[model samples]
Target chain A: MTAVAAPTRRRRQRRHISPVVWLFLLVPAAIEVGLVFWPALNSFYLSLTRWNGLGAPEQVGLDNFRELFSDGVFREALGNNVIWAVGFGGLSVAGGLALAVALNKPRRGVGVYRSAIYLPMVFSLAVTGLFWRVQYQPDGTVNTLLGAVGLESLERQWLADPKTALYAVLVAAVWRQVGYVMVLYLAGLKGTDPSLDDASAVDGASAWQRFWYVTWPQLRGVNTVVFAVTVIDSLRTFDIVWAMTQGGPYHSSELLSTYMFQQGFTFLNLGYASAVAVVIFALALLFIITYLVRTLKEEVS
Target chain B: MSAPAVTAPAPPAASPSTSHDRQRVRRRGWAFHAVMVPLTLLWVAPMAFVVLISIRGFDDIAARGTAALPDSFTFEGFRTAFGEGAMGEALWTSVQVTVPAVILSLLLASMAAFALSRYAIPGRRAILLVMLAGNLLPPQILLIPVSRITESLGIYDTLVGLVAIHVGFGLGFYTFVLHGFMRSIPSEVTEAARMDGAGAFAVYARIVMPLCRPSLAALGALATTWIFNDLIWAITVLRTQAKFPVTAALLNLQGGYVSNWNVVAAASIMAAIPTAIVFFAFQRHFVSGLLMGSAK
Candidate 1:
């Protein structure tokens, strides 16, 4: 420990950090800490107390969490979040990988196809939700199409029905997500070594075999990135859910995010909302910490 | 058009054109198109339907539901969306918040990146980790304190307050990306400048920033789309209708025009137009930026 400390101490003394470094770093650091970390820490404290936003918070040790565990709506929201993580993450990654592979090579009008697939990524979730809401209406696009296809029995009020509301919302969310994931995978594909592809082919490997053995392994870094993004996005999904159903139809579509918002803002149960937020933070930490450790290991080296 | 040369060299042949290889390539191309064409059409159908709905008259939509082909089209929806829906004012508000926020965030992030990458500052790893972790957390976790802080700062309900919040939150991801880019710049170049008596600030301003143009443009386009489309932050901080950004105003329009599909569609399109322009115009830089960030 002393041997390691001596060199770091000597190196630090040798390279004097200029005031300009401090000036440049501290300004942004100060604002970020004040705005983000400070608030986050305060929320952690607030979770352990009861507050109505108008008065000083009264201390309550873990009662909010205890109440959360027994709360039917909270349990529903938690269950829905897990479903979202699976459905959103699984479908987006699968669909995105297929799109990226198809668009990997230069071809006639590939750019057009790529752009057409990706254009949805730029739309705000509010727009996506509103647009899908119209389509999900009784006499809207979806039911109309179903009727035209002679599947009249399949037609339902997509967003209004408690059974279909969450899944319908998931379709819209996945529609937006696939394009972003496709872009990331396309970037990952560009870095794949072409020599390996030829070598595997020469060994009589089929396309599937070549891709699985040669290309898939090369995508470890990007897989880590995609996993991190998809999971976090699933956990924090609020805007589209908010605009479409607002966790409606008797909280059938409720997520931790929307529930937290309703509790904190609408009902003014600030402490309970903070507790929900803490749960979200803990769930997200599972993926965030894993990604960070890998990224930081690479960075520090 | 000249097809882009394949990156992998083709097998050695008697002639540059090999009919055997060409046949296989053609077959593969056909297979790709067979799969992609239908999928692309299906994927883009929702937005296309929205556009179609936006152009049709509300009476037409009512008579023949949204899935039907338009019997006639009009600009009536756009006009009403701009006028009664107040979408134009909301768009202007978004521009005000997004432009300044993106610029300030990039400026501050670039400076921080330069310092972190170039100088051996104390606890550099810790600082970067904090900033990175900050960006990953859900905004809802920080929602209450951010609201209270903005309220206390007396900037609540103002565009300036929204801009500050955007910059504060944006600093982390932007700084991380810029730091990766700056670190790749060879030390010899900065050393040469130092030998010529350039101070740290001068080396940064004259040397480092210009070298980061691609990343800046990419990040700028990205940040514009994100900040413009941001609904949660706008809703959390601003209360007045006039101060609301495009997303919030669009939501209001949706609530008001429940039966007016044309008008709501028009407003949604209007809200999407700016980001679409950015996406198309800067596609190359943004794609490269994604590549660059992942490479780090």
Candidate 2:
């Protein structure tokens, strides 16, 4: 015990290690500072100035804020984004959990279904965007099928209708995203105790009762993560919208992502774009922090 | 797509061979098949349409419309997409950016993760959370600032700049996942090697690294897909069209060539290839990696 204590005491000695470890640490940290932190600070500065990409930024100091408040387009996009968050974030999690719970059994050919469902997730967002575009065309397969079912009157330009376009995009988004969530929830489901399930089964519980009483509570930790992730993700979606309509005929499908990109790049309203970016940054941070706090509180209790 | 739902479990005591059990099983089977048929069709329709339209002759597209099925298939779209030299050029550009970006990010992130796991690093967990937090931030916020910073560094509008941008963005998440994996390994293995007179470098070279093979595989696959698929970032940061990777090149094709559905389908399918290949090749690891990291 004394000898072990002596080695432990010796562990406090200044062991002058080689510089490689510091080199490892500093390289990644330096890139973060340069690319992420430095620019984050610069974005804040640029947000206060009224400048295009090339000119010297004149400090307008919250004048941009005044203009942004009056901007009808920005408000419309903001409302669309909130709708987008609920549709994409809420639906995908519920769908994914339902799928994962359904397939948690050791069924034959389950892996085949899993792979087929996940296959779409492997497609590039650009491709998904294009694919959805094809499906949304006036004479596309979706309309054609609906026409065959004698719902031709219901067939409208899916992506052209401002009210329906974002939701149409959500269909494709859910197609790709649900597999990702399902796979995560499946893994979470794996961690649940089989005996508990068996005991519940022996206690004459129906499947719905078992799920509500046993499965959901056990899966809460995973659900918390999936919920936060989906919300952040839905808010940040860009490629799909950009590929599909670029915020579309009336800005009905406009998300903060597409709006910021257009403002920053095409319009060169860098300051305004930066402010939009900051809002997105804040919302994502809020979701992540809230989830983390909830999880941590659960741990403490 | 909803096949997971078709696999409802019943208690083992309720064997299906019993007549009543058989009746119930048969009913469930038919209901399962009925549900899956349409679901699978809905899921598979988009890809099928793209492929169907891509091979349709231009005359067929003109006569019927972009949505119409081909009377006879042709390779014209693929030929046009590849032969016109646009996609081919884009392919070269994508390879130039993606290969190096994926390799370098994985290498740097793994090395950093190794060091983070092995050493008594200061502010380790906090550093990891910062990285993870960056992952959640919308990439739109970083576009303008990152572009300016790269321009000041004299690499904006270049492929190396694109690679560096990817690395900077990717490092945090990759390092975070790899660190999580490393922490789960029992410390006794490292201690045992140390007691056998293994040096720090030797332990890493011989033990820790070999154990991290699965993680490296997952990271490489995921990073490849992300870099290959990324468009908005690459477009915002990279100005020169010649420097555009496949995604940007494909994106540009959309607005100017809205009427060219044949070409777009072909290009979109082409764009999905690298990711699909990487995905199927290492899918198990991909799922495991995502679940483990997200669970954290």
Candidate 3:
């Protein structure tokens, strides 16, 4: 019916938005545009000027970006962020997928198992960080377990040591994230057709082949959501790292977000922080834009 | 056989194959339990450790270290955290921020979603896509300017400012999800209402909203957890310790406690309880809402 009525409807409504539509859109658009989009756009302008919060911002053009490329700490921060993206994304996706697959089928205690798995996801990252800090202490469970297991050589100050701090923080973050990813994948799995699995099984396909061919194909939508979520998350990760290490032990775990916070709030280099923020914005946009474009194409058609 | 008029029972093929399938499933189930039991325990271990520490005395923890079995159990840590740590006030502050933010964001999002989905509205696609991308932008990107805006508005250090920011930041994702849901509602139903001379606002409030309850509930649960747990925005706009949300206050507690594991553990647990309750209460709706939104 829509296809049949398309032309007339399009011609009639193409440029004419009803007043009620405007009434509905006005407040949300105002809040979104005024608070979020406008400031975000202004951040770009701020990136080109130097300011210390007390004085008026002075125009410096691309100097901040130039300094960013050469600064050693910024380099370390950028590199750590890349590493974080890889480790956090890779582990959470893989682990979540595995758990989702395992728990997809309902059983006697599936709910209990799932709740336990997803329990960590509900904790605030600040809580997760502090909780993990206790676990990572020198005499904490981790080190104690290692000592009991005769792996004492492998135990050290997990958060205090620069070499292990980033990975230590990443582990805690992934612990919190994996369950969330699992829940998404589980929802996606619910939409898959069981008959397809049966058909593949009847054809004598292996479990791996059945999953790769039949099940995975049906999860395209969830994959899109998950990928966007993971990428954006890895880039913008702050609370856990901030709470756990503050990107500390010689800036070993410093992410772009934490570094930006440090630069803007701690040091008051508002311009350079905006520059870093712009970099984070650009990277996140580069990803989410691709997702938005795809979603838009689907919606339009 | 009672079915004498019926044909042969398909050579018993379905029966044998189904039983075979069941056997294989049973085996897989056993394997799953064997693996998942250990993994689940491992996942719960850190949480368990925190609870144990929270109940134990700080003197005991200091003397025996965090890994040792508890020698003393007391509610002193909880008392200290709630009173001296100021977590009790922060919890109330978090409630003030999260409840209003969640309600406002859901209201605005559903309204915008109803309009965008039901009407052509020029530039609708661009608006939706921009909001979608905006939701994904790192908060740090808007940190400096947003704080500046808050300061200039003289609402800095106010819960009202924090609530507004949450609603603003939350609008994009909430609208996107609600739009997906509202689009899935059959146009015929709304058209019938329109034929009855219901105005758009009437249709939205009476028709669209009631149908979007699952999605709204899901988003409400999610937005509550997110806004309650937000530390960055709280730290950014609000400076007074008295006004800090639970998460920000927990961070402060971590700082103040230093290596005092008992008090910190109690405070962390206090900070997490609200969201944990929300998560469990709405777990079903949350998953179903996400599934429905992505179903299209």
Using all chains and alpha carbons, the TM-scores for the candidates as numbered come to 0.94, 0.92, 0.93
Cα displacement (angstroms), candidate 2, residue B60, comes to 0.9
Most lDDT-accurate candidate: 1
A best-first ranking of the candidates according to their DockQ comes to 1, 2, 3
Instruction: Show where candidate 3 strays beyond 4 Å.
Output: A6-18, B1-28, B289-296
Report the CA-based lDDT of candidate 2 relative to the real structure: 0.79
User: Model 1 over residues B119-176: C-alpha lDDT tens digits?
Assistant: 7787887888789788888898898888888999999888988999899988998899
Candidate 3 local lDDT, B1-296, one digit each (tens): 12232122244556877767666767876787799899999999999999999999989999999988889989999999999999999999999999999999999999899889888877887888778667777898888999999999998889999998999988988888888889899887887897898888888989989998877888787788888889999999998998999999998988898877899999999998998998889987755654544443
Count clashing pairs, candidate 2: 0
Order of candidate numbers by TM-score, starting with the best: 1, 3, 2
| Model 2 stretches with alpha carbons more than 4 Å out | A1-17, A291-301, B1-19, B192-200
Kindly report which residue pairs in candidate 3 clash with one another. none
**lDDT at position A145, candidate 3:** 98
Model 3 per-residue lDDT tens digits across residues A1-301: 5688977766655454568888898889889987899899989999999999987899999999999999999999999998999999999999999889877876666778888988898888899999899999999999999999999999999999999999999999999989888888988898899999989888999989998999999988888878877888889899999999999999999999999999999999999999999999888987777677668767877
Return the TM-score for candidate 1, rounded to 2 decimals: 0.94
Clashing pairs in 1: none
